[model samples]
Target: MMHKPEFISPDWPAPANVKALQTTRAGGFSTGNYASLNLGDHVKDNPLHVAHNRQSLSPFLPTEPVWLQQVHGIRVIDASTSSCIETADASFSTRKEVVCVTMTADCLPVLLCDEAGSVVAAIHAGWRSLCDGVIEATVNAMPVEAAQLMAWLGPAIGPDAFEVGGEVRAQFIAQDAQAETAFRPQGDKWLGDLYTIARQRLNTLGIHQIYGGGRCTFNEPDTFFSFRRDGDTGRMATMIWLE
Candidate 1:
């Protein structure tokens, strides 16, 4: 059977050697709540089903993707040498055929590559990681010039649906006063624009070439897994590699 993969390419002009893909919550052998194509092994899904699902994705990737433990912190691991699930939110690799991957439900997955395709990275940016500087950490870990780097924002909770408390807003506001613009008043709560905040962070790091931030996982249940929508949903994977 052929597996159908949903992928988005960054709009910026990247080197022909760079390749990337984002998987949707479709086309797999998982059952029940997972249903199909659930890539997260730690999400209470059956290990056998999860293994089968991963095997299905292997043909599309050059090699096994470097999966992270994802502690929602700013550490960026060097995938070329890391063996274990490094406690980090982002990972970078200059080695060809080693895929850098990030798993997310509502959290944003940001893929990065330079103009020359010499390096590639995958970031798991939830509110905490985004506010604490995961994007900045990824950029700093890369050897490529910031101006030459391009990014693609993957599916995430839309601003209209991502309601948060004042403390969440304060976390970002404390980082950059201008971050307040990404939040909109919603009664006693605030609707946060994760995409806009990510863009601002990248722009501050000098990575202006960015794309693919319009997808809303929370609303698109058929195509994506949303943690905010379904508390125990499976995760979708966003992967990047240099060919």
Candidate 2:
């Protein structure tokens, strides 16, 4: 019997029809640094193992997820209409059973849905994309009012583990001076908080209902894949869809 993969269901008050799944770095076939449940194919993991890992998720989802070629940009796509893997950092769907997914190791994966369960989105928020306004782009794409949206921040490099230089800090501050609060001085570097920054962004868009944070990918080796911690590593998938 196959050991089923483990998942983290978002702990939020999303409508019963809006479903979400967050994968961990466990219970698949890829071995070594990509060990077990490595869902990303571009990380140099064995192709067959990658295929099997993705296939294993089929039972839990209504359909295959629309995996994007994330480039740390702010592009958002409609998963309901996308037929091929698109180069976008975020995807949303208003239709039922159209799964939107974003893969990340240390980068923050954000899942969003409206109070009405009419739409849901998955965002790939690396520091670069976060700084560049991926969250804002996705919110803009959604037909619902920002106030109707609730966001769930997934596992990522926590503030204590994500150290960055002055340049990275500068970019975020340039957009919003309040972003400074999300960083703390660490010698010449700064420890950045992806969750805080993400919440700040969502709040700015009138989205106040936020949940799920404090899980650290970089610090949790056994449970998560962190690109910063392990250069040659797997990726965890965060997915959402309307039922």
Candidate 3:
């Protein structure tokens, strides 16, 4: 029997009915680079392993998660109406037990929910989508006030590990001059802080209730599968839903 993954539940003060979980690279059937609980079937992991791994996660949720075919873009779908892997970076749900899920390796997985527990969402924020305003788009999509929404920033490539080119830095700085503060020059390239960038974006939108974001996929090899560190790697997931 396959064991369940080591899941990280958000510590944010979301209402009692709003449940969230972020899976680590543990407890599943995948082997080799996609070892253990690799949830992403698109990553060339064996379909049987992927299916069984996903199935293993079922007892933890109200329904099967609505996984996104993430393209690092800012497209959020309504979780209740979507079926089939939708081409989106984020998803929100109002209907009970409808899971909104995002798969990520080194990319940031942001989970959002209102204090009242009426809405929740999961966002896949890679550098491309992060710079493209995915966080802002998600905040705007939720029915609750931005102030009432609390976010949990999941594990990602930390500043010391995430090396970005000059162009990447320029794009963020172009959007907001203050974005320069989020980047520090490391030789010819720059060390980008996804968590800091996310906070700045969320703060600008008046969302101050943010938690999580210290874990690094690159540094913690045993706990996370970092795409930047491993070419053919598995992906963990961050999911949320209303009870």
For candidate 3, the TM-score is: 0.98
Superposed model 3: Cα runs more than 4 Å off: none
Tell me the whole-model lDDT of each prediction, alpha carbons only: 0.90, 0.95, 0.92
Which tens-of-lDDT digit does each residue in 70-160 have in candidate 3? Answer: 9999988898999799999999988999999999999999999988899999999999999998999888888888998999999999999
In model 1, where is the ten-residue run with the lowest total lDDT? 3-12
Give each model a TM-score.
Answer: 0.97, 0.99, 0.98
TM-score result, candidate 2: 0.99
Worst 10 residues of 2 by lDDT: 1-10
Which candidate number would show the highest lDDT if scored against the true structure?
A: 2
- Give the CA lDDT, 0 to 100, for residue 3 in model 3: 80
Clashing pairs in 2: none
Clash list (residue pairs), candidate 1 = none
